[model samples]
Target: MSLHSLDVRQTALTLLRSGVRNAEVARKLNVPAGTIGYWKHMDRAKRGECPGRGSHDCPRCDGVPLDHAAYAYLLGLYLGDGHISHYSGHRTLTLMITLDDHWPGIQDEAEAALRSVFPTRGTCRVRVKGAHNIKVYSKHLPCLFPQHGPGRKHERLIALAPWQQEIVDEHPWSFVRGLIHSDGCRITNWTVRKGKRYEYPRYWFTNVSDDIRALFTDTLDRLGVAWTNCTRYGKPYNVSIARKESVALMDAHVGPKY
Candidate 1:
C-alpha cells in the first residue's frame, strides 16, 4: 500500500505492541510525537482492541508493586474489619511467621493452613497467589506461625553485629527484651494472666529474646543503674532504668561479681 494510504492508528498499535519507540513512529509517520500514545491508550480500553501482550495496556499493571495503603488494607480485610471485594485482586489475608526464611517453597501450604486456623465466611478462597519478598517485616512472619507445613530440625538465632553481640553476651535479657517489637509478638503476650501485668505497650507483656548468661554481670554492674531482684543474686524478676530518686538504691546492692 502507498504511504499516504496507511492508517496511523493501526501502524501505531503494531509498533507500540512491539515496544517500539513513539518517536520512531512519529519520525516515520511525520506526525506529532504524542499522537501514538493518545491513539494507543484510547484503543487499549476497548475490549479486543489492544494490540498484543506488550501493548499499551496488556500487562500494564503487572509487576507494579503495591503501596502501603493497599498492603494495610489487605491486612485489615483478613481480620474481617475492612472492605472486601470479589473483583479486587488482593484477596488473601496473610500474617507472617517470626522465624527466618528457610521454609520450603509452600506458600500454598501456608495459605491453606491460615484458612484452616482462621476460618472466614467469604466466598473467595485464601490462597498463596503471589510471593512477596519484603526486606524485613515479612521475613519473620513464617517463624511465628510454623504450621505452614512441617518445621525443620531446629530454629537458628540470627547472627548479630559485633555491638549487638556484645550486648547479647553481656545483657542478654535486654537484647532479647528489645527484640520483641522488632520481631513478631512474643509468647508472654499470649498468656492470659501474665499478659495483664503491664499497662503500656501490650507488647511489653509478650515477647522473649534469647537469654544470655552474662546479663546479670554486665547489666547490673553498670554504676548508677538500679535493678531489683526477688531473690538475692538471682536473675531479676523486674528490671528497669533507674529513677533519679531511686539512684540511692544501687549503693547497697551487691552485683554478681565475676
Candidate 2:
C-alpha cells in the first residue's frame, strides 16, 4: 500500500471518489492520509480542473461554486429532508480549498459567491465548522479566532443584540441544520473526536444556559430556529443569516456582547 507510484495516486483518487475515506484508503494503501490529500490536490491542479477554492469564480464550470450559501442551503436540505448518515447524526459536506481564515469575511465571501451563482429554488446561507491555522482542514478547524480567547464564544452574547435578536426572532431558523464555526481563519485540518476537546472558538444555541441564553434561544425558537451540532463539529441548531450581524459584532466588539 505504498503511495509512491502513479498507479497508487490514481487508485487513491478513485477510492476517494467512491466514498472511501482518505484514512481507510491510506490504510489499505498503507500510506498517510496527508499523502492522499497531497496527491489529490496535485492531480486536480495539473488537470486544470477548477479547485473550487471557496470562491464564486469557477469560471471554468457553469455549475455551483463552493460558496457558503450553497453549502449551507444544501446542508439545510439534508437536515430537513435528507437521510441521516448511518455513522453520524450530522449531515456533513466537505470541500478542500485554500484560505487564510474561516470567519468574519466568510459570509461576505460566501454571499458574494452565492449571488453570482444564485439559486432559483430558495435563498442560500452558510454555517460551517472551521479550525485554526487556516491550513488544509478536513472538517473542524483548531484554534479558530484566537484573538477572542476560547470556548463557545459565550462572550458573543452582544452579537444577539436586541435588534439583531429581533431579526432572528422574525426569521427563526427553519429546515436547516445549524452551522458550526471553528477557529480556523483559513482552513480546517482537523475534526472533533472523543478524546479531542474542541479548542476552536464557537457559540451555540442548543442547550444554551443562562437567562440570557433564554433570550437568544427563545427568540430563535419563536422564529423556528433549527441547526445541527456535531458532538464533534459546531453547534446543534440552524444557523441564522445574521451572518452579517455576527461579523459586525465580532469586528467591532471583541468582548462579551453585553
The candidate maximizing lDDT is: 2
- Could you tell me the C-alpha RMSD of candidate 2 in Å? 18.9
Query: Model 1, residue 226: displacement in angstroms?
Result: 55
lDDT of 1 at 215: 34
Alpha-carbon lDDT, every model: 0.33, 0.36
Model 2 lDDT tens row, 43-122: 44333333334333332233343334344332222221122111133222122222223244544433333343333222
List model 1 lDDT by residue over 1-258, tens digit each.
123334666887788778888789878887667566545544543322322233121112222222222222222122111111112232222344221233333223323433433332112233243422211112112222222222121132323235333433544333332222122121222234655653221211111212221232243355334434333355333233234343333223311111
TM-scores for every predicted model: 0.20, 0.21
Q: Give the top-scoring candidate (TM-score).
A: 2
Q: Flag regions of model 1 displaced more than 4 Å.
A: 1-6, 44-65, 68-258
Off by over 4 Å in 2: 1-152, 156-159, 174-216, 223-258
